[model samples]
Target: MKVDGEVTTGLGKAAYFLSQEFYTKEFEKNLGFIPYPGTLNVIVSDEYLDEINEIKCNCENLIKPDEGFGAVRYIEAKLNDVIVGAIVFPAKTTHDENYLEFIAECKLRDELDLKDGDIVSLEF
Candidate 1:
């Protein structure tokens, strides 16, 4: 599946969660790299919202979190056909259907030079 969206600022919470050893270990084990201690947030284009939601419903690969945290499901993805990563969605996420949260081995914003409103595509 391919999803396109504009980069956006997140709530600044992923750094804390991604920094947790339990989650980082799982990310390294399941996604193949220790994720940078943050996520790159995207708001799916209106044209792809429904498609992303459908994909979300069918997704199965998950990283179970410790007590008090929500399970996260991910799909392997390539950002802009360059950097490899995963699109993650927490079971208890506050985001709606339009949001896509990505994690990778490096901080995506710095690695990709991304900023709010920049358009990017993810292929999974």
Candidate 2:
């Protein structure tokens, strides 16, 4: 799956959850790296929303929380051909379908030199 959209800012609270030792440890173990303390927000294109939602409907498609954390689905993707990351949707999440959150081992914004409204390509 591939979804392209413009980069956007988040509500400025991801660090509270993402920076937790539990999730970072899990990410490092499963996703292959410890993510930065945040996610790169993307407003996915409307054309791809349905496909994303469809995956959400499939129970097997989601990555459940390790034990105490909220559930999230992980979709592996490539960013700009140089960086690798995943689109994360929290099962008990706050984001709308259009707003997909990208997480990488590195700080996505710094590595990508991204700003809000910059178009980002995500290939799964």
Candidate 3:
């Protein structure tokens, strides 16, 4: 499926490959398995287009996955410096399943104002 959004910083060939590899490894480490082999579609939002552009221009690099199954495709949208919203592409076969869980977790985190190093475990 084609996911359409605003144009953010265009990723280079090497960056794209590295990002894919990093996500693959992170998924295995976190879930004790690899994602279902499939081509995942990522859409970058226009809201963070300028920020992404600035980062690329200055650093010549994009933010990579942070040692997890979920990776930010593009900032999607932001409120101030905080990432209020984003589009994450997981290698899982069903994107909705992962997305729903993400939303639920975000809600809980927001409700409790959870901080870094706090672990939230879900039974699935």
Provide backbone clash counts, one per model: 0, 0, 0
**Leading candidate by lDDT:** 1
lDDT scores for all predictions? Answer: 0.87, 0.79, 0.33
Candidate 2, residue 96: lDDT: 75
TM-score of each candidate structure, all chains considered together: 0.93, 0.87, 0.22
Model 3 C-alpha RMSD to native: 14.0
Per-residue C-alpha lDDT of model 3 across residues 22-94, encoded as one tens digit per residue: 6556444543443333222233345545654454244421235556533333223222233233223333224
Residue 68, model 1: Cα distance from true site in angstroms: 0.7
Can you tell me which runs of candidate 1 are displaced by over 4 Å?
Answer: none
User: Which has the greatest TM-score?
Assistant: 1
Q: lDDT of candidate 3?
A: 0.33
Comparing 2 with 3 on TM-score, the higher-scoring candidate is: 2
RMSD of each: 1.2, 2.0, 14.0
lDDT of 2 by residue, 69-99 (tens): 7876676778877788777778666777799
Worst ten in a row by lDDT for model 1: 45-54
Tell how far residue 41 is off in model 3, in angstroms. Answer: 11
Local distance difference test, candidate 1: 0.87
